[model samples]
Target: MSTQGLERQTRNYLSNNVPQIQQHGGNFEIREVDEEAGQVTVAIGGACSGCGIAPMTMKAIEHRLPESVDGVSEVKVVRAGGPRAAVMPSKIDEMDEMEEYEDYDPPF
Candidate 1:
């Protein structure tokens, strides 16, 4: 099949079979599709950036894409920005300040 056809098939397979991706506010982008090598590169983006389950998601894609998409012998899934460190209030004063905003309505 042509490179474009393979890419479309891969995308369709993901869209239809992978519900978790979209359910978690995440999306995958086909970064590269090498027809001769039968390799595909996919990047997970959006809320998946710092998601704990991202590694499992990638593994699932790597394992399943090739089985479902014709001409795809290998799959590589990566995060768009990698995982991010979560930030939180570390002190009581900061926590109080945060609580203050809980009831403050925005002007907008």
Candidate 2:
């Protein structure tokens, strides 16, 4: 299949099979489609930016896209804004700590 055709099929597959993406204010873009190599790169954006579950979503895409899209043997999913855009567990822990200290004031 041609690259454009594969890309369209991928979009349709994601839209129909992954409703959660849109429901959570997230959208995906086809970054690259190498028809010759049978590789497709997708970027997930919007509210999925700092989401903790994005890895799982990416994994699902990696696993499922191939099954649904003919000639797409590999799917590489990347976070739209990259690693800094992800909310790490340490950040959540820090936020929790800040909440605990909300009532305390340091005398300087």
Over 22-86, each residue of candidate 2 has an lDDT whose tens digit, in order, gives 79888788999999999999988777766655656776788888998899999999867654344
- Residue 57 Cα positional deviation in candidate 2, in Å, after optimal superposition: 0.6
Clashing pairs in 2: none
Candidate 1, residues 49-96, lDDT tens digits: the string is: 555555566767788789888899999987665343222214322533
Q: What's the true lDDT of residue 22 in model 2?
A: 79
| Clash-forming residue pairs, model 1 | none
Task: Give candidate 2 misplaced runs (Cα > 4 Å).
Answer: 82-108
C-alpha TM-scores of all predictions? 0.73, 0.75
**Lowest lDDT 10-mer window, candidate 1?**
84-93
